[model samples]
Target: MPTPDATRFTVLDLLDLNLNEQNALNLRCIGGRKGLSREITVPDLNRPGLALSGFYESFAWQRLQIFGRGENAYLKMLAESSNVEIYDKLFSYPIPCCIFTHNLAPSKEFFDAAERGDCPILQTDLSSSEFSSRVLRVLLDIFAPQTTIHGVLVEVYGIGILLTGDSGVGKSETALELIERGHRLVADDVVDIRCVNGSVLMGQGANKVIGHHMEIRGLGIINITHLFGVGAIRDKKQIQLVCGLEEWDANKVYDRIGTEEMTTEILGVHIPKLEIPVKPGRNIPIIIETAAMNERLKKMGYHSAKEFNQNVLRWLESENARALYFNRDDFL
Candidate 1:
């Protein structure tokens, strides 16, 4: 996993990001254009209602300030009263920026205070709650814990499977076969993974320059999209299962019954794992595909291994009962 950094992003970077329309915050600069370069270090947002009320004891001025309808109205009241003390106190801190929700216009005093403080003032058409939720979601994703792993990630049967092993373990080769079988390849060689919502593991390519490109020992670097079209490539995927390939060990006993489920933890999230032994003739790609399908079945509450064990027990019981009955009839 990549180490966390004290990354800082400017208000202009946030504005320039091309988020999907459904999750867009619709932010636009209304005033304090000179402060657009202010840094937004934290992902959390702050409501300045208390600050506007002159409660500066525990003000979170470092956060991106949010001014909803109530805060806007209070600012108007403060403007009418010619109360400049609260604004001065609030703007004294290095506030990153102020956002007005519901497309609310800022009062002249509020704009003047932002300009003087060099804090950017932004507006959004979304309601206060909607804007808050959208901005928070985006920020959480941006600030999520990230790491890079040497593996190949692919989507097989709608399940994201991460294949890992030592060098020349054929991780990319298996992924190529999976793609040939109509599955989608997420990343090759260097898989960039992030912890989303503290429970989900999201994987993508580490570098966009060589994204969807795989390096096979004999074939060199190949572009999956160009060879297999767009359907064979995916930008990102939620990693659900991890498959570890190892050189065949004759002395080691592999799980043949599949009765025991194994898991590997990444960033505090445990993901289902399968260790497949590699051999001269073993079909690694097919095994991975079956593993992915079985994982999906388990998610749907149908565990193949458990079901197989139950069926075996039921059959044994029936055979035992029949044998006992036949023996009793012979005795009679």
Candidate 2:
């Protein structure tokens, strides 16, 4: 679900990305240096076995090409058979690049053809499966669906909460209070949200220049990390709950019991949501804290509202039975 702009990443950018040390693929330029500037516009990868076998009908030229052990063996066979036309047809398209996994090197003829076509060739020490899985994960993240929202994302008791409301509706103030109460702030104001793996919604600061900073109307801009230290701020967090704040509406009937669960959808992912009516006396931060804890409880299969309802029903049934028995005794 990536946008066109997000898919404009080049091979040079991929090589230069500061990926996690544990998940690093140890990639390096093996050949075809001129094609390093070539753009990779998709998160998918293709194994060119069919193309190497002279079948190029539905070849996926846009995706990054992977040459694993099988493909390398076939390339050698093609070379032995003196079949050079497949290579010519393969490199004719604007393919992003070719990656050799497990340090597998290509034939001299293949290298010569790639150089002629100006296609970048990358090498990695990881096995074919390992390299493919790692690359796919990184590409999926880069190409995930993303959006920017005006809200505050915070982690309270290990729960990710996204607070949203109209401008000047105390969203920042509530987050400040939570930070004071030993919670971590992910992002304030403009929150950049991304849907990862088609299920989880991750949130971070939209602007890195002003990350972990909040703007209060009267106080202007304030840095949360400087005032509260590193423990108060985080880079990103998964949004598990959405809390919408609004001015107290007396006419609207709010959910007094927790049975009626509400949700908000973002990028096709439905997240639990709550509408909190802000008032002068209500402690918004504390309420949010309780809501987070309650959400955790619900995840653990304990629903307070449902339990209360069951208890009320049991009490009503017992009373009705006692009344009927007493009336029968009186009639006898």
Candidate 3:
């Protein structure tokens, strides 16, 4: 199962905690993660009102990181802190994470203290602005769940082929061919996969933007939905397979028989996987199609190698029986 996004929090966000009288801050203290208490202690700042310090205690900053939107009170409090560099970095960070940086690197003392009940700290070398930008991009990338590349996603037979490589790796070209052969296209370059259950992962694109676009290198962008109509596209499908394209390596050993099944785990879900080396003379699109079809057959209770081995064993037994029973046949 894909791990869901992390639950977020901050020092300022500590107020609305309304924690139980136990005064624990570990996972259990929050009533979400068990035994999470005894990790961090919230000290009494002993101040109130709109001064810089008070804002840190405010609900705004706390809520923003948790909910992905910051409030005013916390912002003002952060500005007032003496740890100017730390304050800037925290403000710049879009996601809520315990930070230990620059002068405030955690000591054995602090680590031991947090183990008992303190916030874990993160250390970074970048300046406030640079760190902030990096953190923001990470946060946005995680939370957005919408930054998608326009391409085609197809479930050929049962194998999910995610055609990706360098530009002009013929990813889209292969997909276009597969689609013409009546295979389903799930998404283009951008595939939105959500873990629906413990082992099932489903893929689809935004409905509003589904089946509508393709990005070709020289042609730039083309609207696939407009040209091909709705039947040419798909909203979503279960991700059961993965086929990655790579430049050919003669020395590399590829799967000669379907005996060894490889899998890739995403978000916690594992799907069967294959790496198809790309080369000039090889017909990749057809090869991918055949792979998908073969996988489908395996799922349908047929093991080609096992069946062949069984036949060979039967032939050997029959020959041995005839040799041993030669006298018995005449006696009977």
Residues 1-332 of candidate 1: C-alpha lDDT, one tens digit per residue: 12233366788877876677878989999998999888888888999888888778888887889999999898888888998778878888999999999899977887888899888889999999998898988888878887789999999999999999999988989999999999999999899888999999999987677799999998999999899999999989999999999999999999999989899999889998999999889999999989988998999999999999999999999987887888777545
Over 1-332, each residue of candidate 3 has an lDDT whose tens digit, in order, gives 11132344333333223333333222212211222221222211111123223344343332212211122234334444533344343333222234322323432432333333333334434443344444443333333322233334687865666665666677877887787777767777766766553566667664533344667677777776666667766666777777778788899998776577788776776788888889999888899898787777778988776777789899999877887788676545
* Highest-TM-score candidate: 1
Error of 3 at 204 (Å): 1.8
**Predicted candidate 1, C-alpha RMSD:** 3.1
Higher-TM-score candidate among 1 and 3? 1
The lDDT for every candidate, in the order shown, is 0.88, 0.90, 0.52
Query: Candidate 3: misplaced stretches above 4 Å?
Result: 1-152, 158-160, 316-332
Better of 1 and 2 by lDDT: 2
Pick out the ten consecutive residues of candidate 3 with the lowest summed lDDT: 62-71
Candidate ranking (lDDT, best to worst) = 2, 1, 3
* Highest-lDDT candidate: 2
lDDT of candidate 2 over 109-220, digit per residue (tens): 8888899899999999999888888889888887888888989999999999999999988999999999999999999988889999899999998766778999988899
Which 10-residue span in candidate 2 carries the lowest summed lDDT?
Answer: 1-10
Write the number of the candidate with greater TM-score, choosing between 1 and 2.
1
Per-candidate clashes, comma-separated: 1, 0, 25
